[model samples]
Target: MSETQKSKPEIEAPQSPAPEALEIVDLVEGDGAEATPGATVDVHYLGVDYDSGEEFDSSWGRGQSIQFPLQGLIQGWQDGIPGMKVGGRRQLTVPPQLAYGPAGSGHPLGGKTLIFVIDLLGVK
Candidate 1:
């Protein structure tokens, strides 16, 4: 199905232990432009905590896509979003070190693995 035809995505709860490294999965591959490092991206996304399967954020919930420079996001996003094409959907499983940091790093999500489903809408 085309990216435009798909509705908001729902992430299934993971049954396995979180990995020690980053994991990337493309749910839908878009045919548009490829996103390069340092590019600004417009995307719709959902974020959930790996252990509790609880949602922490989602652009879909707000009924809009967010746009930002790729370099300005968290480590996981900075590492994961580049090389994706606009119109594609990708899932990222980010370990704590690549996410907020090891558990006591002070960020609310510190020490936690995060799961994110991202839809690339545009790249600039």
Candidate 2:
């Protein structure tokens, strides 16, 4: 983490009727390099269930950011994160099919829509 890093962000609960497809919204656009589909990204992110409005994961909660290969993440992330630049903040609303899949698929978050707020730190 850098000294310029922002503190953890707060995600508001979403209203009913999650979108049927992936939704990407840029909260803060960055001036740094843009991310490519094959890039490895370092980011701080929070994920919550759209229906429950309960946090399910967070890199900020761990007091550190995480670096992951884009291909290794869920389909929603893979589709949503590219084109985002380092230092940007983005929100993604992901339906079950793009998140973990429908209920009984065994991933816990399966069958649920998910909301993620991501702060991009670096891309390589």
Backbone clash count for every predicted candidate, in the order shown: 1, 0
**For each candidate, what TM-score against the reference?**
0.95, 0.94
- Residue-wise C-alpha lDDT for candidate 1, range 1-124, written one tens digit per residue: 3645257888888999999999999988888999988899999999999999999999988998899998888889999998899889999999998889987888999999999999998999
Lowest lDDT block of 10, candidate 1: 1-10
Tell me the lDDT of candidate 2. 0.90
Q: Write the per-residue lDDT of candidate 2 for residues 29-63, one digit (tens) a residue.
A: 87788999999999999999998889999998899
How many angstroms is residue 95 displaced in model 2 relative to the true structure, after the best TM-score fit? 0.5
RMSD of 1: 1.5
Off by over 4 Å in 2: 1-5
Native-to-model Cα distance after best TM-score fit, residue 120 in candidate 2, in Å? 0.5
